[model samples]
Target: MRTKIILTATVLIGGAAFAIAQTSHTGHSDGMDHSAHQQEQAMTGAALSEPGQGAFAALSELVRVLEADPNTDWAQVDLAGLRAHLVDMDRLVMDAVVIETDLPDGISAIATGDADTIATLRRMVPAHAAQLARDDRWTVDATETNDGIELRVTSEIPAVVARIKGLGFFGLMASQDHHREHHFMMAQGKDAHGH
Candidate 1:
């Protein structure tokens, strides 16, 4: 009987404490609302505070167009800068293969060939392939005119196959994530020391 009475008192005290805590925190449980914060950010021009301001600006414009007109044809929109960047990226990958011969190679080549060039080629080709895959400018389509040699995005725009079609090279030979990381870091604002 004594133990039961003591246990009932403890439960009553604990329940009262929990009720007080709930009443005290009733109006403040949700904390800061992020959607409202984002709205304020948009109002005060904090939306474009990132280092890639131009890219963000372009994205904002695209968003605005889509929001204003649901039927907006984004492909027909004037994305000159975006298009130029895409084209430049594609051309860079295609050109990366040209400088491949300067790399080093081991005893894998034929009787007469520069080993360094072979090595460089082996490294660069994979990098080129990865870049080509990521480049959104050139779309990969099936109805290409040249079988396995050329890739067609549309009826008008055509580019060469990315996988070294004649040489049978299909995948990246070295790490390509580093290249992506480097590009992303470069896109960000420079440090105080211009790094």
Candidate 2:
């Protein structure tokens, strides 16, 4: 009786696995075998069968190469398909975060020192911010500062808002000096006289 029960359990589990393997999934773009046999092989440590596998393989190779010798110059490293998932918009925001995050600690914000950088950044992030605003992701708030225009994103994320209010992303561009006295610029650099 115990032997029969064990055989029955094994057969039932195998049947369920077979049923799941036949169904198609829509969201994932990678074309690969989703069969139970393939899953079992993966569980057993075989090579992964998916589109981004090559990307992962490349990353692994990069790590190995770097590990073998730590002095690998960054510019020489090949990053093919390394950023396949990042959209242009996300890339721009990421760039802003990267730059702005480098500002001095405890600073609520940092303004761009050059007109070119400010204009370009504004063109990139504000549009995304505007869309987010419409969706109530942020409230459109623009204030004139001593150096240049200051765009603020007022959102409902209290935690993020608190951090931004405390140690946030703010800055002024050196080009628009006229707006200076009209607003209290946060950082270094004196009034319009290129000071």
Candidate 3:
């Protein structure tokens, strides 16, 4: 009876260990599959941001049209020019420099610089104004300063400009968040082995 009880206990323990091992193995396999899918998406440019999606979709359609008919009208298939303009717009947004200042009512953000910067800011103002109009929490005023253009941004809440920095035409519409994550991960001083 003592030997039979010992064998039964051993079998139970071994079964539990096998179950735990199988669970961990299945989890690891699912993780690998998910990682591969994400890698595939990144490889295929499926991770484009909003602006990138617009540009990519336009270009893709243009390619399809051209492929269907090599003699397609050059005017109709001029998406490359449109793509170039989109790139320029993106560059203007990414290169914009915003300076924030404290105000009695709210925060003030000044986007000013050289002539070229002023022109870019001016071009972006209508789009920003449209966005601000949609959001009733903020108000904006624009004026030409001696150096460049000053945009006085006010909101009911504090740090409004900083909060809304990623929304308007002046904001970066591309998928640069991964770069920021990589930089943060590197700054954390943790290696691949989690050291």
- Locate the minimum summed-lDDT window of 10 residues in model 2: 182-191
lDDT per residue as tens, model 3, 1-195? 999999999999999999999886776544466567578888998964333375465456545645677655545444444454445455456666667565654445566655666675665554444434555667767665555456555667656645545343244223223323322232333221111
Estimate TM-scores for all models. Answer: 0.20, 0.27, 0.41
Q: Which regions of candidate 3 are displaced past 4 Å? A: 1-81, 157-195
lDDT of 1 by residue, 1-195 (tens): 999999999999999999999886675556846577589788888744443444455445455545588665555444444434334343333432321211121111111123433333343333354454564543332111111122222112222332232222222322234443333323332211111
How many backbone clashes does every candidate have?
Answer: 6, 7, 0
Best by lDDT: 3
Please report, in order, the local distance difference test score of every candidate based on alpha carbons: 0.39, 0.42, 0.53
Residue-level lDDT tens digits of model 2 in 1-195: 999999999999999888777554442356655586577887898875353554454455545655577665555443432322122223333344322332122222334445544554554334433433453433544444444445564546765455444534432222123332311111111221211
Candidate 3 clash total? Answer: 0
Question: Whole-model lDDT for model 1 versus the true structure?
Answer: 0.39
Task: Give per-residue lDDT, candidate 2, residue 164.
Answer: 42
**Candidate 1 clashes between residue pairs 3 or more apart in a chain or in different chains:** 101-117, 103-116, 103-120, 104-116, 104-119, 105-115
